[model samples]
Target chain A: MSFVSLRNVTKAFGDNVVLRDVDLQVDEHNVVCLIGASGSGKSTLLRCLNLLEVVDRGEIEVDGQTITNGQVDVNALRRKIGIVFQAYNLFPHMTVIDNVTLAPTKVRRVSKADARDRAKDLLERIGLAEKADEFPDRLSGGQQQRVAIARALAMEPKLMLLDEITSALDPQLVAEVLTLVRELAETGMTMIIATHEMSFAREVANKVCFLDEGVISEEGPPEQIFSAPQQPRTREFLARVLAAGRL
Target chain B: MHEVLQKFFSPHAFRVSLPDVWTGFQLNLKLMVIAEVLVLVLALAIAVVRGLPGRGATPLRALAIVYTDVFRGTPLILVAFLVGFGLPGLNIKGLSTLSNFTYGVIALTLVYTAYVTEVYRAGIESVHPSQRMAARSLGLSYWQAMRYVVIPQAVRRVIPPLLNDFVGLQKDTALVTVIGVAESVQQAQQFSQNNFNFTSYVVAAVFFILLTIPLARFTDHLIRIRERRERAQLT
Candidate 1:
């Protein structure tokens, strides 16, 4: 069985359907990149897997546990699946170290000292060690996004979801965040990254899934999807991204 | 100029009334401090109840809504009279025996809590929904998320406005004089009635200004500092 599985997952917000009969599977330690246009349900799909949004239909299992069912402890399940957002929603009232340590100390019951140590290590890894005492508002957008990633990493999650994490960064800062994700991929972390950065997705994704509207129109190894996409919609989307010199 | 000013000001009468007003001012300060604490705690509780999510909290939400609307709409002085005299008049065994001062505190706390609840609710709502999402996505339970993440930020943002309400509450302590609690305004009025001079009222006004000016300036200082920090962050 795949480490993460979504079977016939459907979600709607009032009258607007966001995800329609979606089915996907990701093996352990694999990097799956979800590439699509804006409003194509990439972010919503990631939200559902983390239980941030409930599915109107179908089931989601992470590591053989059915996370979508109401019987599961949602909070405990969330601890196993970390998600980073496009806007870098760091707790502004907290210092960078506090933001990183909060979940570990509060949710996981890690000792304060131990959480601080782990947060420092994560900050150092993200090249934000010196910013430990600084509040989120003081940091640049790129730095804040990195700290957000570190905040997620502190949980030691089994599967990490990146929801267009670089979409909010400046063109110059995008490379730095993408490089960090590439390093995580190298370290064998299972990740499903929703991204608009075609080149970064191509470089890091083991399997690339092209989403059109609310469903995956085409999915394959990066080389196959990028060069020889079978679906016309996938080809059309890629042609526009390529024309924009993004791939 | 000095002679003309002295006729209206009556510095001698003002000085003579100082000790008397000081005692009464002390009572006002005491009420302000105690009621301030109670208002902060009670108002936050009410705001949280109104903000509670999902269908299970509907009745509680409705109760909180009614409470805030009723108390906020009623005049504070009327509330003072009702609690101070009316409750005791009902002759509920234990409640009837409580001092008028305690009733004054209760009345002020209830009235101020309603106003503060809306301030707190506005602050709590101003925090971007994404903050809740971020906190929850980290496995923090709903209450845990609110306590550790949301409330702290909300309280910080509302501090200036909260202080403004506190200043208003401090001044409104004089309103309890109508309930016969012998606060500064009442003592000043008694002195004026006896001596047939209004100078004691000036002393009471001075005491109130002295108490509230620092708080008002401090609130302004906090607002300035917050503005500067936000502006600096934008750059």
Candidate 2:
């Protein structure tokens, strides 16, 4: 079975349909980058993976464990899946170490010493050991996002979901977050990232999925998806993204 | 007139007996403490009940609304009278009851809990839905979210307003005088009546101003700090 699968996933809000009949899969030990225009359901799809936004109808399975039917204990399901958002969403009142340590202590039942040690290790790995004592609001956007990554890593999640983590940062700050993501990719973390960073997607992702109107327009190795996309819509979308020159 | 002048200019002019003042002050302090503690607990209960999502919320909310409105909208004098006097007539047999002092505290809690409930609600709602989602997604149940994440932030945000409510409640303890609770204001009045002078009234005014001004200024200072931290985050 695929490590992560979304089968016939559909999401709607009132009269607006955001996603429909979406089927996708991510194998273990691979990075899958989802790229699309704004409001093309990219972020919504990532949210569904972790069940942050409940799907109207569908099944989402991570590590062959189904969570979308609402049968699974959401906290248990979420413990194995980590999510980082564009806004960083770090608890402003908490220090970087505390933000990273909270889930491990609460969900995993780790001792305070162990949680603190692990948080410190992750902060060091992210080049943010100096920030461990600082509250999130005191950190730069780049540093805050790195702390967010560490916070997610503290849960020891098997799957990490990235929803435009760098889009909210300054242009110079974007590279630092992307570089950290690149390091995660190199370490064989199974990740599904929804992003507009075409260059990073082209470099790190083993596979790329181009979503349009809540359906995968094309899916293939990064070479085929980026260089010679099969779908005209994918090409047009990439053309616009390239012209924007953010990559 | 010379004797009056002598009384005014004597070193004993402002001499308040510590034992006597302490007795009245202790009672006043006790009443304020009791009323503040009860108000916080009752407000928390009412807020939780109002926050619940069921048929229970309706009646609890109604009760909370009526409790707050009747106490806050009308004078505390009326509520203290109704609780201390009016309830005695019903005299439901075998129901052990509260004393005038106890009823006064209850009355203060009932009135101010509603006011503080709104403060808590505003604080709780000010927390972005994302914060709750983050906490829940991190494996906290709803109650756990409130305990570990939401309530702490809400309480922090509501502190200044909650303190203001508390100070207001402290001052309102004087209203219990109608029920014959000898708190500071009542004691001061009695002292003045016995002495046939306004010295006791001036003393009470001095005591109140001394208590409230510093607290008001301190809360204002805290609010400014919170705002400064928020503004610093933006930059």
Choose the strongest candidate by TM-score: 1
Per-model lDDT: 0.93, 0.82
Write the residue-wise lDDT of candidate 1 on B1-235 in tens digits: 6754554368887888788988999999999999999999999999999999999999999999999999999999999999999998998999987888999999999999999999999999999999999999999999999999999999999999999999999999999999899889888888888877778888999889998999999999999999998898777
Task: Give the clashing residue pairs of candidate 1, or none.
Answer: none
CAPRI-style quality class for the chain A–B interface of candidate 1? high
Model 2 TM-score is 0.92
DockQ, every prediction: 0.87, 0.64
Fnat per candidate: 0.90, 0.59
Off by over 4 Å in 2: B1-22, B53-74, B87-97
| Number of backbone-clashing residue pairs for each candidate, in the order shown | 0, 0
Candidate 1 residue spans exceeding 4 A from truth: B1-8
Position A15, candidate 2: lDDT: 81
